[model samples]
Target: MSVWEKIKEKTEAGERLSSEEGVYLFREADLHQLGQLADGVRERKVGKRASYVLNRYLNYSNICVLSCQFCAFARRKREPGTFELSVSEVVDGAKQAVALGATEIHIVGGLHPSLPYEFYLEMLRGLAGLEPRPMLKVFTAIEIRHLAERVAKKPMVEVLGDLQEAGLDSLTGGGAEIFDAGVRERICRGKESAEEWLEVHRTWHGMGGRSTATMLYGHVETAEQRVDHLQKLRGLQDETGGFTGFIPFAFEPSQTRLAELGKIRRASALEELRVIAASRLILDNFDHVTAYWISTGLPLAQVALSYGADDLHGTIGEEKIFHMAGAKTPVGQTRGNLERAIREAGREPVQRNTFYEAIRS
Candidate 1:
């Protein structure tokens, strides 16, 4: 049977595709064909409403111990301009985010080599104590793992439990650069290994904590590797069912060791669309697929809605990681801009909280 025939059969049966089938969908399917299949899956799950949020990203520090080659954001502990935000300073930033109508505070920072585990707990407490507190979605699995071993000196499960008690709402999928160890070794050595990243999320999911899964594509990863990454996430979701969304980000090559090794190039618009559409089709157990506007740009991100994306992550008042790594998009977007984009895509826009609960617009 032809590949299209197999994919259609799987779609008809409402069965999940294998990794090889997903790879074929990424590489061989035409635009409309892939979009139609993905949209069918999306409709079966999320319906017609496109979800969004108003949020702010706080990069609390640039001081990091692991210098990943693909990273353009982290700085050495003794680097001239390296900095860390005190607990009071992060709270002040959260105040700014809340005053600007943000309902969620997204926080991710470099792994501090010396900070104790109590520091993270203190940050979460500070955010939780604010009036009209926004949901605190903070920390990557790598940072969590680091804290577990280096600071808390406890197991991953216990450490995560402690943080949950301290008011961490969710985990962001940042440390998952790519799930292939060969690629990981070349791009982001000395950080959490692929297995470790998965294990951390597994631990979180087992504890009933929800988080998003991400794939960092378009750098040195193969189409097959991308499928493998998705498949691994799918397998985990099947077992634990704690993933809230899947976000596929193309690697930014500027101002990093990856660029120094060669000329930096961003993923083409076509590649972004293909990944979005394919993600919708493959991640059968996941409820939402997000087009992160900061990384994909407004134009391509708007187009992504038709391809299979049901969520436009947020109107981020400020974003640092993408900008520091050569993103040319605006840091802030208005509600008007978000509504227009969804309308232009022929979809209804609904504002939502971090948990996908609708907020009255």
Candidate 2:
């Protein structure tokens, strides 16, 4: 048989595809054929019940120490738009979200050069104390490393332990752009290395914690590099089994240096669906693959369900990062809106908590 036929046979048999096969599928597989294979896998794994979370996003601060070339959200400490919420302010915002029926409060921020380690613990403590506590999914692997190596000056294990004690339910899947060292250096020089990012998650999993994974694609990365990134994530998941889901973020080029340099543009909708479908196939070990509507508009995100996505991330309240990058989606979607979208896509909508557990169907 030909290479494509061989891949089709393996995929049909539910066997793991090699990195070469993943790259080939990503580059050469017919879009509809790939979608069929991926949708078949998704159906076997999670069925037609798609999910959404009633979650709120909180960016505690924007003053970052590193100037990643592709990031439009980070600002200098004295920059005009720089802001950091006090612990009380963050708790108050989360309290309002909880009152409005949010089941998860997703928080992430830059690697601030000055916030003391106590600030994070205090913020977590206050949010944890809220009545009907929500799952506090906070911090990326990069932020965790920053807290350990910079602010806390403690070991990563110790820092994660402290954060968990203070009530961190899970880790956010940001900060993992493209994991290829060459491409990563071109876009996000001085950011944590791919190994460092993986090590952070590995350590967290060793502590019996769970988190999600992400890949920021459509930037300065090749198809081979993208497959390599997925292979690495799959290897880690094989070892730890701690990843709850995978989110593939399309690089939003507007307002970013890459855009200014004329080196990048937004990924096309076809590319976005291809990435989602490829992720579903390659990351077979992962249970969920999220079509984050904040970056991909709701319309395309709705189309992504038939393309292989099983989860429409969540109802994020006022997201700044993607908005800063010129995302035009609404700041948030209501539960009714999410259900309507799912139902329109010919799938049953399931209300899910952070762990993909159905809160209601």
Candidate 3:
């Protein structure tokens, strides 16, 4: 049978596609047809309302030790621009986000080698003590693990316990890049293993805390590897029912080690859209899929609404990661901007909190 026929049969039966099938659809199926199928799936699942969060992106520090090949955002402690924020400075950023009408504070940053776990706890305490307290979705699985194993030299339960006590609402960052070990060895060596990454989420879910998952695509990975990555996340979601959303972002290759070595290039628009569509089709257990407007431009992100993406992520007051990797999109967007984008896409704009709960529509 033809590739399209196989995809159609799976779609019609509402059956999960194998990795081979996913690869075929992503690589061979007509882009428009794949998008239509994905849109239909999206409608069946989430309906016409699209979601966005009004939040600020605050990275606490740029100083990091591991030199991931695809990263342009991390710097050694002595690098010219490398710095970490004090608790007071962090509170200042939180106050600024609140004054700008933010309801969530999205915090993620480098894994500082020597900063003690108390730093994280104190930062969370400072934010939670503010007058207009925002939801604290901070850190990634790897970050938590780092604090537990490297910095704290203890158990994650202990580290996570402190954060929970200090008012950590959820974990929100991308440490799960590509799960295939081979790809990880070359791109993000010394990072947590795939199992380690999943274990972090599993442990968090067991603790009653929720989190989001992300896949960094358009780098040195194949379609099969991408499908495998999604499959692993799908399995975790099925087992725990803890992931609130899935975000897929393209790799920005400018000024990174990957770019310097000619190992990777920017993903074409078709490739990026195809990944979004494939994710919606493959990760059946997920409730929302983010187009990640920070990586994909607003125009294409709007197009993604019809292609199975249901969330534009947030009006990130200032995003540093993508910009460092040569992203040209605005560091931040206003609520009006997100609402207008959703409305223009012919979908209702729903303002949501960190966990996909509608705050206002």
Candidate 4:
């Protein structure tokens, strides 16, 4: 059988696609064929309703010591743009987000070198203490690992336990840029290792907590490496089943250090759709694959809904990480905008919580 025939049959049979198949689909398969296969899988797994959350992205600080090359969001401790929101400030933000009908407060930030552990705990406490408290999906595993080893001098389990006690709802999936160690080092030197990232999610999964997984594409990774990242997440989800979904981020190279290298540029529209389709085809064990509208832009993001992405991510009341990295998409979108986008794509828009629980059908 032809390579395309074999993959088509495998997908039709509900069989998992191999890494070699993933590479072939990424490199040679017809884009429309891939989209059809992925859309079928999306329909079976999540039906016709595309999903999003009423959430706000809150970055508490930008003072990061890890000088990642692809990050324009982090600042050295004394840099001019460095800022840290106080507990009261975070509380006020959450209050405002809640006032706007937000059900979740998505929090992530730099690995601040000197913030006391109490700062994190109190931040969680403050968010959890708000009226009509929003679900607090805060901290990536890397940040959690930093809080454990560098800041608190404790085991990750203990650090996670403390944050859980203080009302952290789930983990974020920002740091898993690429699982290839060589690529990781080139783009982000001091970030968490693949093992550390997986272990954090595994540990959280054990505690009945949920998290998302992501990959930064079109930067310094190959097709095989992208499949490798997906396979690792798939294997772990097979073991623990804690990941709520998978998100694909298109590398925006305008302000990042890697942009100076003539080799780096924004991923082509075809490349973005291919990555979204490939992610859905390979991650048979994962339920949702997000188009992540903030990075992909609403137009292409709408196109992606039919390409196996069943989630548009969320309202993203305010997001600075991608903006600092030169994303032209706005920091937030309204429910009206989100719903209209879904309807325009000929899909029903379902409002969801952080866990993908449908709040409004």
Candidate 5:
């Protein structure tokens, strides 16, 4: 059978594809054919509803210990422009986000090498104490690891348990650049290793915490490496069933060490669709796949719906990571705009909480 036929057969059988099949789907399948197959799988899982959210990104600090090659947001601690948000500052941002109709407050920031574990807990407490509390989705596994080792001086399990008690609703998959160690060494050396990253999330999941998984692609990584990354997440999801969604983020090479390589081009629209489709086919255990509108523009995000992406991420009222890395997409978009994007994609839009629970907007 042809590659397309094989993909369709496996998808119809509700079977996950092997890494070879994932690479084949990435290379051989036409965009439209891939979207059709992906849509079939999406229908089997989520039906015709396209999920989105009215959310906000609350970046607490820019000071970082790991000066990753591809990141433009993190700043060295001694840098003149480095800043950290006080507890009141974070609460102020959450208050504004809540008032603006944001149901979820997504928090991610640089790994503060000197901050105590209590400070991190206090950040969550401050947000949770808001008069009208928004769901606090905070921290990546890397940050958790940093806290455990440097701040808390305790085991990862203990650190995670403490954070959970503090008010962490879920984890946002940020620091996972790619699971391949070779690519990791070249791009982001000082950050947690691939196994450590997974182990942190795995420990969180074992504690009954839910989180998302992401793949940062379109960098020095190979197509096979991308497939390998997905396979790793897929295997983990099968084992723990902890991942709430899978996000495939294209590497933005603009203000980092990788950018010095050349004027890196964005991932082609076709490549974005293929990655989404293949992710859906490979990550059978993951229920939601997001097309992050902040990273990929609104038009491409809309197109991704047909290519196996069922979620449009969140509002991200003021996103800094992509903007710092030279993303031209607007910082904030209204619910009406998100709904129109879903409608244009020929799917119904549904607002969802951080855990993928339907939120009536």
Candidate 6:
């Protein structure tokens, strides 16, 4: 049989795809054929039940130390429009979200140069103290490492433990932009290495914690790099079994250095679907693959359901990172809006908690 046929047989038989096979599928497989194979995988995993969480996004501060070329969200300490929320301010925003039925508060921020380590613990404590107590899904691996190495002067495991004790539910998968060293240098020069990103997550998992994985594609990376990134996440999942989901989003170049240099354009909708489908096939062990609406917009996100995505992320009220990067989608969605989109796509919409457990059908 042909290589494509062999890959198809392996995929349908519930087997993992090799890195070369994944690269082949990304580069050579027909789109429709790829979608069909990915849909089959989605079916085997979750059937027609697509999921969303009643979540709110909170970026506590935008004043970052490092200036990643692809980031439009971070501002220098004294720059105009740079803002840092005090602990009470953050608590107030999270309180409002919790009152609006938010079950999860998705929090991430730039690596502020001067925020004390206690600031994070206090933020988590305040959020965890809410009457409704939304799940405190806070911080990316980059932030965690920063807190540990620079602010706290502690080890990663110790820092993660302290945060968990303060009610951190899971780490948000933001800083794993692209694992390729060339791509990393071009985009985010002063950021953590791929191994550091993976090591942070690995340490968390070793402590019996769960987190998500993400990749920022459609930038300078080639197809092989994308597959390599996926393989790295897949390998980590195989070792830890602690990942809750995978979210691969497109690069939003507007208002960033990349766009200023005129080196790249936004990823097309077709390319977005290709990544989603390929992600489903490549990360076989992951239970959820999110078609993040903030980057793709709701229309394409809806279409992604058929292209192997089984999650629509969340309501995500008041997103800043993507918007600052020129994402034009609505800042948030109603639960009704999400259900309608899922239903319109001929799938059942299930409201879920942080861990993909169904809360409502």
Cα-based lDDT at residue 229, candidate 3: 95
- Determine which window of 10 residues in candidate 4 has minimal summed lDDT: 256-265
Score candidate 4 by TM-score against the native: 0.98
| Cα lDDT for residue 184, candidate 5 | 90
For candidate 2, the per-residue lDDT at 62 reads 95
lDDT of candidate model 6 versus the reference: 0.92
Instruction: Name the runs in model 1 displaced over 4 angstroms.
Output: 259-261
Candidate no. 1 TM-score: 0.97
- Candidate 6: tens digits of C-alpha lDDT, residues 18-127: 88889987788888889888988999999999999999998899999999999999999999989999999999999999999999999999999999998999999999
Residues 106-153, model 1: lDDT tens digits: 999998888877788999999988878899889999999888888888
Write down the RMSD of all candidates, one decimal each: 1.4, 1.0, 1.3, 1.0, 1.3, 1.0
lDDT of 5 by residue, 1-361 (tens): 9777887888899877877888887777777887888888888899989998788898889999888888888998988768798888888989988988888889998988787777889989888887677888899889888888888899999988888888888998988888899999888888888899899888989999999999998888887888888888887888899999998888777666565534667788788888998888888888999998888898999989988899998878898888888888899888989999998888988999899989863
Best by lDDT: 6
For lDDT, candidate 2 versus 5, the one ahead is: 2
- Candidate with more favorable, higher TM-score: 2 or 5: 2
Model 1 residue 258 CA deviation (Å) reads 3.1
Question: Each candidate: how many clashes?
Answer: 0, 0, 0, 0, 0, 0
Task: List per-prediction Cα lDDT, in the order shown.
Answer: 0.87, 0.91, 0.88, 0.91, 0.86, 0.92
RMSD of 1: 1.4
Off by over 4 Å in 2: 259-261
Model 6 residue runs over 4 Å out of place are 259-261
